[model samples]
Target: MRELAKVQGCLDRARGGLGAVLVVSGEAGIGKSRLLREAARHASDSGFAVHVGAAEQMTQTRPFGPWLDALEITPSSRDEDLRSVAVLLRAAILASAGELGSATHVVIEDLVDLVERLAAEVPRMIVIEDLQWADDATVLTARAVARSAAHLRVLLVVSHRTGGLPAIGRRLRRELLDLDVATDLPLAELDHAAAQGLAEELAGDAMWPAVHPQVEAARGNPLLIELLVAAGGRSGEGDLRCALREHVRDRTWALGDDGIRTLQYAALLGQRFSPDLLAEVLGRPPVEVASALQRAIEQQLLISSGHDLAFRHDLIRDTLGEELPQAVRASMHATIGRTLARTGARSPEIARHAALGAPRGDREALELLRRAAVEYRRLAPAVTVDLLTRAESLADERLPDQVELELLWALAATGRTGSCIERAERRLQDQPQPATAAAVHACLGLIRQRTNDLDGARTEFDTAVALAAEAGQIPAAYLADAAST
Candidate 1:
């Protein structure tokens, strides 16, 4: 309620031509979206033009996805300057994926232009939710929009998890606050009184004492409080996660075979997904998928989110996904990964499925991970290391282990030479065969040289050439060129 008041204050300021950026951040199930929606409703009621959108983990590879969601009703302006905005929107819709380039900057600039132009016409509130999963381009655009919103007649609101933000997302938060043009709203756990009151409201009775134990168990998370209270006479259960899973299963049991199968399969897609996309993955008609999803809606398991359906809470989807047996989960992940690949989803999104779904030593999965690592190398430092690490775990002791070399390079590039050295030693111990070890040494030498350890690097390079010649592999000199990457 206090956060809502603060956000509403920003709206009032925007109405007076003094807009500001508000960054809302909190842990999972902490009512961040709920608060945002409440403020948005208030703005709408007060005659402020409002637009809303959110990002999802499954579609993080799509460019400007959240902006696309927020501006759903855009591009109808007959103003000549707005034509470029419409053109950019159409291009984004047509392109399934995008790389880091000047074209992306054009789109971001046009988007800011559109917002500034429209705000000049009327006061506005633009809220982008779940920014933690936003693609690189979306995060960049958020920065641009925030800078423009500082003095325009538009209040820009963005929410992300307390710890899940990408590098750019964090930077935006810090930069705006440092400039004194933004408000940081970090929502902590609710106090006892508020938690008990929320429990009483959810239960619709005047009995906070009866629900006090549930409140304590949920630790002030609104979603968990509701779940625990609705769990129906299971107050004695201690293992909340297991109990919650069983509760979900009990609810889904009535959905019958088709509905249960649909939910389990959809869980692999992400926190939010379009029924049309799910249908394609299942190789079923849209109507069939609709029927199953409709059943979920009836069960209060999934809620409509624009053109997509999202599980009522992330835990529900995660529970269903975890309920699958190990082999079944892996098979489903494999199926989803392969289907996404054949259907032209970008590497970053597909690589997640490949890492979880593909069988051991699946070279195709490794290749996908490698490509994804390359895509993220310059864009996101953390993701590059993560993807390459996953690839290395799946790689066998092949002579030319590109996964290992790439992982070391990424670790080194990110100033993580300690990890680089450790992993290189492990590679040498595990895959000491001439071709692989020689490559690892060559890569380590390059890192050492970068760090200005000239004598040490020279020694390592000499050892690499000797190993290459001993194995009769690619020319010893070639190892330097190959591994330097």
Candidate 2:
């Protein structure tokens, strides 16, 4: 394929006695693993020694897991050199003698030496998949190999997701970027023509106008496209969601209850979440939350970005969210809202959780929505209208008249004058307190002005002013300022 050409170039460079490194990066199911396989085939055909190792998302706790896989060294291996290196590497990782730091150095040096030996015998190509889930020691060893490969007939191909790389992965990527011997090959989605070709190949003569929509929906993701074609282009929302869930099941199912719960909370928090906020929502200790996050990072399910962690793909988060029962999701949202409230979070953030989490007629949610509306009134009138509208829907007859006034004002501010007039007329029928009555009249006056009814607007404004003057000083001043406009 076109993508294989670039990888084949790296293999060619290695064969020419020039060491090369190719880092293939893409989102999930974007063919990174497949590309590595293609590179391996090309290398093997060119009489190069090919070693492939894949990092396991669930088994990252095993140090040097991918390296061991690549070396294929057992305690009873027939190859003496391989056995010797594996033994040393195991000791280095385990630090059985309690000399961890020095052992790690030995491990890196031995790995570099092993690569040089392999390259000296024959051009060697090593492919490490899912480096994003590699442990710290494994990452360091790979980095060491990459640096030493510059002068040897070695080609190193490392693949990882583009997002959600842990700190070690990020540092390794940055170092590779700075190295002259390395090439960064970021795979983009296929173009319309290429995607259509893939669809046709998968579906054969049955492919038609229906395949066009599937390709469009697949958004150039090869795996998604393949799935769509396999499903006969009947990939509905539920089907797509189910597909995504299964795609990441291996990474998630291995997690403990705490880890699963951590993921659930993180999904509820949004695409990116802080450990502190997550801990607060779960009512767990920060240390406990951190451990779960570490596991997620190791599994490649979450990428640590500074102080926060994000799902490797938005689809992963969406899939998890869709699987959550409505009651549990709403309860979690309410818990998150309460936690955020304690942190003095902004109104919109707090209101979002509160509105979703709180059931119908929940006073706390209604209050939070009103507060959010007030915060958004000037900054974002549309948001203000939305929050107030939700609050209006949730408010009971015993709800304060101020909420209705705020809703009316927010609706009018958004130029939704018709709705504002209707709400104001309903509020007036309830005979609200004088101060709230004045606010409603002022809101109606604004709506009348927007409708080009100058006389009606003037009359409403006059009535508002009269009611405000009788109510109190604050009401009179507020209405007076409103009437002048």
Q: Using Cα atoms with residue i matched to residue i, what is each candidate's TM-score against the true structure?
A: 0.49, 0.66
Model 1 scores worst on lDDT over the 10 consecutive residues at 231-240
How many clashes show up per model?
0, 1
Per-model CA lDDT versus the true structure: 0.78, 0.79
Expressed as tens digits, the lDDT of each residue in 161-183 for candidate 1 is 77566578788778767655588
Give every collision pair in model 2: 164-303
**Count: clashes, candidate 1:** 0
Q: Best-fitting candidate, measured by lDDT?
A: 2
Which parts of model 2 have CA positions greater than 4 angstroms off?
1-28, 40-221, 224-232, 253-256, 272-312, 396-399, 431-442, 445-475
> lDDT tens digits, residues 1-485, model 2?
66788788788888887889988998777789887877788788889988888887678777677887887866677878778877776656566654456677776687788788879999998888898778777788889998888789999888887764788899999998778888899988788888888988887775555555657766677887776665664554556566667866766765787688889889999999988888988888999888778767665568878878887667678777877899999998999988898888888888989988988888888888888887777788788878877776666655577666666666777777777778788888988878778888877877787789999988988888788877873555655545443
